[model samples]
Structures are given as structure tokens and as C-alpha cells.
Target: MAPAQAQMGTIFLLFIGISKAINDVQMLKPIDLSIEVLILGEVLLSWKPNVNPELESYVVKYNVLIKTPMKEEQYTTQNNSTKRMVALHKGLCAQVCAVYYEREKETARSQWAKAKLQAPPGANGTSITNLSCVIYTEASNNTAMDCSWLPGEEAPEDTQYFLFYRYNIHLEECQNYSRSHDGKRHSSCQFAKTDIQITEDTIVVIYVNGSSKHSTIKPFDQLFNPSTIERINPPMNITVALKQESLCAEWMKPVSVWPSPCFTYEINVSDWVTGSTKQLTVKDNSICLLTNSQSRYSVQVRAAGSDLCGNSKQWSAWSKPVFSDKPQKASVLLLLFLVYGALAGIMLLSAVLCTRFQLHRRLFPQVPAPRNPFKDLLSYNEAPTEGALEVISDIDDPEPNE
Candidate 1:
């Protein structure tokens, strides 16, 4: 009887194992994916878990996919809920599924659960087009965000447009606005020292909307990660000098909140003598080139944040040019001296030879005319030369008689 009871107990344990294996392989689907609005342009996604007590020891993770007209993103996480900040003006859809896995392989996967938010109602062509934005760090450590857009063709003339930004939990309405030249129609907005905290994330959302009596104006929103639209500042205090025969340039980093190490520079050297321009990109603040020192150059430096900080896509405008000392005036002075010295040397030699050899008198000796019989008939105004010829004869030594 004892052996029979023990055998029965073994069979019962085997039956329980078979049932558990069947439960583990059963396909469980997730339920009710939902989006909970947290704030403007932000939402929380939550769903019911596909739990199985039998698979307690195995790890279960959820795969979430968010889709938009422009792009789609997919990620896996162990949590059933996630928080996201995204542009909602165009609307988005999200889907989630449960994945059951062990240390080695996936045992099972649940079906997908989907949720969607419909786009706001408006005419297709009434939404503003060509929206762009730029963010910059001011000298006072303040952050400014500038955005501009073109009016939609279908939009009404008197439609009043407004710009707003959402950062984390804060939403700001742009108070400083710029109007188009044709009319008082708003076309651009600037946020000076935005109360919205500056951060390195894709959470910042810029939204533009308007009210119109003629038709419903569609709103527009875009996500920014801070670096994409940032406009770096030009490098500061560019100084150029010749160092040990090298053309060297130096400058401080741009006026930004980031440290010097977080920036790189682009240096432009324009040789006015050779009429050639050279450009160098360096991670360091100072650069030296073995260039023609005699060639005067105009150098300018521009800076951008590096990957160490948030790298910028746009480079700053070029800084004011700094000129190196004009090729030394000493070279010109030396050339003039050599030319004058040669002329002076010739003059001195001529003077010495003239004093020693009476050169001028030998080359331009006075000639005496033959005594003419007619000279007696000429007037006495002509000076008599009969005795002058004998005095000039001594200037030339008499040659030896042949």
C-alpha cells in the first residue's frame, strides 16, 4: 500500500508539470493601451499587463512603438507605462505588445494593443508652412529662442497667429513678436530669456496656432533637442601675430554657457600678398601655421559647440577680421639704401679719378685753330691765341721723337 501511494504521488506531480507547461505556451495578449495627457505636448502611455503566474520566473518585457506621419520609434522596456514628450498638433499613434522570454530564448509573445489620437480638425491647406526655429545662448547667460513661419495660402488675411513653447512642465507664450512687412500680420516670434528652462532634450515643443473667422486654422508643433536649432556665436577677440616665423592666431571661445573645452573653432587665413585663402578647423583655441610671414593676412575665427557639449548643426557667423603686422617696412628701407649706396659709390670714384688724373681736362682739351692770314683783317674783339697755345702745350707730356 505504501509503494502504491508513493507511485500515485509521483503521477500527481507529473500531471501538475504538464499543466504548467501548457499555461506557459499559451498566447497572452496585452489589453487597453491608453494615453493619459499630462501636459501640453506631453503624455503618459499605460496598458494592462499580460501576467501569468506560471511564468513568474521568466522575464517579461513590453515593446512599445510610437508612429507619426514622418517617423516611427520602437523601444523595449520592462515597465507597462512610459512618459513621452512629442508634437501633438499632427497627432500620433502608439502600439504595445508583451514579450515573454527566459534566459535563453523567447517563450511567447503577446498580441499588440494600439491607441491613437486623431489630428485636430482644420482645412488641409490652412496650416502654416515652412516653420523653423533657432536657439542661442546670450552673453548674460540667458537663453533665447527664435521661430519664424510663412502664412498658409488658404489662411484668412486677418487671422491672428500666436507662438508658444512647452518645456518640461512650463508653457510660455511669446510676448515679443515680429510682423510681416506687407501688413500687421505676425510672421515671427522671439523669446528673450525664455522662462522655459534650457535643456538638452527632445522635449522642447514649439507650437503655433491662430484664430480665424473664415476657417478653422490648424495648429503646428515640432520637437527640438536644443542642439539641432542652436546657432553658435562667433569666436571672440581674434588676435593674429607672427611667432618664431609662424603665422599664429588665437581667440577665446564664443560667448556661451558652455566652457572653452566644449567648443571647436574654424580659422580663416586670407593672404593678401599671394591672393590665396586657407581654412583650418581645430579643436584647440589657438593655431599656428608655417606660412609666409612677409605676406600680410586677414584672419577670422568662428566657433561651434563640440560633442562634449551638445554639438550644433549651424556654424556661427564669421568674426571681425584681425590683420597681422604688414610685412616689415625694414625690407623696403634696406632696398632703398642699397640703391642709393651704389649711386653714391659711382660719384665718389669719379671725383677721386678726376682729382688724380685731371680726367675732364684730358677728354675735353681746348683746340687751337691754325693761324689764318685773314686773322689780321678780323676785329680786335677776338682774343689773341698765339701765346695761349704755348701755355696749354705743357698739359700733355711730349712723346719721344721717332
Candidate 2:
């Protein structure tokens, strides 16, 4: 009986040993589990391989962690959650961890990888600010101005920045000129390309960060004209005599002149008839002057200086032209006399009509004749006669003086 019991016990021990050895072999074999992180759109997550010989499937575990300069936050999965975790911001730095499993055994966790991360190139996420241009009086041209943006929290010290420029002549229309660099944390750069000559009503625009600002300047010629005449210094009343021949002309200056004149006088003649223009520079004011022969000549005097600024005063309005040939004096006098006589006749006719009207009003007055006050009241039988009055008197006196 003892031998039989020992044999059964040996068999039981062998069974237990075999079971333990099998479990150890399973644990020694590596589970085929691998993880890969992928970023798609807004969500970032990990994926596992399905064709591993050892693992029928994989159990993936993931968590998101945000690391900013000021603070950090961590989120985990719960309640059978299988979807990929979303990032808080595209510009913020983040990390993702992924774990792989095969059936009941945990295999491996992937190394944390950068997830949904973005770092702008410059301070304040912008390279340039307040980019503008103005007419620089020192440079005798236009120049650009700009300010640097403040540094962002996560940006590196060695980040690079690109500066761009565009000029708009009209609203809603833009033209790109050139681009430059803001090296080593510089905030602004003067645009060296703004050297073009600006005309009247020219609008200039500058752009930065996909936005724009504008300025305008008027033309220089409109603001500064060299042909403007100054006021005369000393007042003078001078008579100008003009004479015109077929193609030549002559003029006489005023008999009176001012002392210590600062400018030299010149005579300019423009003929509309022949389409010719001539100028004769005169050193002294003279009585007689000759010009090129022209049918119609406009004469004026100019005060000029030899300095760089050139002449300052233009001549007064052109003098009336005089024909070279004299007309018949007798005929001109006759025409004038006829005109005077006609005007006198008209005046005399007006006076006669007015006098006749007055006389008519006086001779035939508008007032009616005086009317008799008792005409309507008196009747032939009712009128008191002289005999009635005498009868009354005789009655009143009684038998008087028979």
C-alpha cells in the first residue's frame, strides 16, 4: 500500500512541475507589441501594429501633458475611452505617451514625442510692428520706420524673422516692392527702397502682419512755383506807349523812374498773328525800343536777376497795341461828331415828352367843377321871392305911415 501511495504522489508532483514550467516559458517569450504616434488634424494619438505573431491584439493607453513656461497640466483616459486625445493649443508645446499591451501581459510604452507643437519665429509671435514711411528731410527722400514686437513665452533666442513690404497707390490695390531681414531680435528696419519722387496727391501705403497703413503727400511744383511774381517795392505811375508795324514793334518806357533799382528790365513780345515770341534784354530804361516785325505784338516788361533763383517779377498786363499807319484825322472827327449828335437828339426827345406830359396835367386839371349846394333842395313853387319878403315886412309894421 505504501509503494502505491508514493507512485501517486510522484505523478502529482510531476504534473505540478510541468504546469509551473509552462507558465515560466510563456513569461520568458517577448510579446509582439509596438506603438507609433501620429498627428492628424487637431487630434494626436498612437497606433499599434496588428500583425504581431505573439499578440493577437494590442491594448493601447495614452495621456496628454502640456508644458508651458508658466504652468503644466495632465489628462488621462477613463471609462473605456478609445479616441485620440486633443491638444489645447496649436501654438503651445505638448507631449504624448503611449503604452502597448498583448492580451493580459503589458509589453512596452513608446518614448514621449512632441505633439501638436508650434513656435512662431519671433517675439510676440510677430517679427515687425508699426511699419511706416515718411519723407525724410535729412535724407532728402522718403524712409521707413518700424518697431519690434515683444518676445513670446516659448520662442527660442535664436529664432529668425522675415520682413516684407507693400505699397498701395489706391485703396484695395497693393504692390509688392521688396523684402528684408530683421536680424538678431531687431524690431524694425528703415526701407531703403522708398526713394521714388512723389507727385501731387500721391498716396503711400505700408504693410506688416497682413495689415496695412497709409500716408499721402502733395506735389512739389504746386507748393513751390518759380514763376510767382512779387509785389512792386516802390509804387510808380508810368504811361506806356506801344507801336506795331508789319513784323516789327517799338515801346517807350515811363518818363518817371525809381532810384536804386535791384532788377534789370527786359521787354518780351509775343505775336499771335505770326506765332513768334521774342525777348530783348535792356540794361537801361530807354524811351525808344525796337522789336522784330510782327502784325500783332503783346509787349510787357520783366524784372529779372542773374541769381540761381531766377527772375521774380513778371511785367504788368500787356499794353494796348498801336497800328503803324495813321488814320485820316478829319474822318475820325466826323464820326465822333455824328455819334455825339445822335446822343443829343435822344436826350432832347426825352425832355420834350416829359415837358408835354407836365403841361397837359396843368391845363386840364383832374379835379371836378364845384357843385351848387341847394340845387336839389330848391323847387320853383317853394322858393321865397322878394315880394313875399316885402309883404311879411309890411304886415309886421302894422298900418304904418298911411
Which parts of model 1 are misplaced by more than 4 Å? Answer: 1-26, 50-58, 195-199, 326-402
Clashing pairs in 2: 124-152, 148-187, 200-219, 247-293, 247-294, 248-292, 248-293, 248-294
Tens-digit per-residue lDDT, 288-346, candidate 1: 99877567788998887777876584679999989887455534666799999999999
Models 1 onward score TM values of 0.76, 0.19
Provide the lowest-lDDT 10-residue window in model 2: 215-224
lDDT per residue as tens, model 2, 165-194: 332222221232333244444344444434
Model 2 TM-score is 0.19
Worst 10 residues of 1 by lDDT: 385-394
Off by over 4 Å in 2: 1-53, 77-90, 101-108, 123-402
